[model samples]
Structure formats: C-alpha cells, structure tokens
Target: MQCPRCHNLMVEQSFEDLRDDTGSLCFKGWRCITCGEVLDPLILSNRAAHREPMSGRARQKRSFIQIGS
Candidate 1:
C-alpha cells in the first residue's frame, strides 16, 4: 500500500499500543518507508476523530512551578 500523506511505498509492520491509547492489543499496520508514517486501523480511527496530536500541551491548562529564594 501507499501512504496517503507521503505517497510513498508502505511496508507491513507489527507493534503494540497502536496509537498510544490505553489498550492491550498488538496490531499489524503499514509504515511509510520515506516519511516514517504509521497507518493502522487504530491510528486511522484517531486520525479520523481529529484529536490533537500528542505534542506541545499534554494537558488542557497551563502548568507551572514557582521559584523562591
């Protein structure tokens, strides 16, 4: 299969925790050889849901620590 994003040839790969979700399932997926993109049933679901990527703000609100002397 070809990657939708990169248009590169995809190879079959297997891994656990398909999309970083709290599930105990191992899945078979396709990975882009050029862009390192992963495409699987689980990943596709999350992508379709349009959930925010797991970067930048992991939490909804800002967190900080105060420094004192």
Candidate 2:
C-alpha cells in the first residue's frame, strides 16, 4: 500500500496495545517506511468520518501580542 502523507511504500506490521480496554492486545496495521506513519482500521474510519472539504480561501496571518517584553 502507498502512504497518504508521504506517498511512500507501506508495510504491514503488528501493534500491541498494553492498556486496551476492549480486551484485544494485538492488532494489525500498516506503517509507512519513509514517514513512520501508522494507520489502523479504527484510525482510518475515524479520519474518514471527520474529513472536511477544502475551501479556496487563503489563510489569514495572526498577530502575536507580547506581554512584559
């Protein structure tokens, strides 16, 4: 599989959750070799559900107010 963040090759790997509350300790996921990004089933679903559409508006710059300088 290809990574979404870096567009690199991803490898299958097993991950262990030590403090799992659902009683499953081991899970299978994919990891990007270049960017070290991990993706699991739960993570993928959550991201898909919460995805937002991109807009054409440019971002505004913020001014920082320094105190006691």
Candidate 3:
C-alpha cells in the first residue's frame, strides 16, 4: 500500500491494543516507511466521514514530532 501522507511505500503491521473497549486485542494496519504514518480501518473510516473538499490553494505541510526520537 501507498502512504497517503508521504506517497511512500507502506507495509502492513500488527498492533496490539491492550485497553480497547471493542475487545479485539490485535489488529492490522499500514505504516509508512518514510513519514511513519499509521492508518488503520477505524481511522480511515473516520477520516472519510469528515473529509472536506480540497481547495485550489496549496497548503503547507506541518512538522510532526517523532514519538521515540
């Protein structure tokens, strides 16, 4: 899969959610190799529901802090 944020190669990875209320302990998601962005099924669905149309103007990319830096 391709990462939506960086247009890089994404690999499927398994993640463990210990405190999930849905009772599912493990789930699969895609992780971007370049930008370290993660996308799961729930997150994709939420974004789709609240997605807005893109404007003609270009937007600047915001810098993000790496968790384990």
Candidate 3's error at 50, in angstroms?
2.5
- lDDT accuracy of residue 21 in candidate 3: 72
Rank all candidate structures by their TM-score, best first, as comma-separated numbers: 2, 3, 1
Candidate closest to the true structure, highest lDDT: 2
Off by over 4 Å in 2: 20-24, 53-69
RMSD of candidate 3 to the truth, in angstroms, is 7.3
Please, what is the TM-score per model?
0.52, 0.64, 0.63
- Number of the top candidate by TM-score? 2
Q: What TM-score would you give candidate 1 relative to the actual structure?
A: 0.52
Q: What RMSD does each model have against the real structure?
A: 8.0, 5.2, 7.3
Model 1 weakest lDDT span, ten residues long: 60-69
Better TM-score candidate (1, 3): 3
lDDT per residue, candidate 2, 19-60, as tens digits?
746775888999999999999988999988986545422221
Model 3 off-target regions past 4 Å? 20-24, 52-69
Candidate 1 segments whose C-alpha is farther than 4 A from its true place: 18-24, 46-69
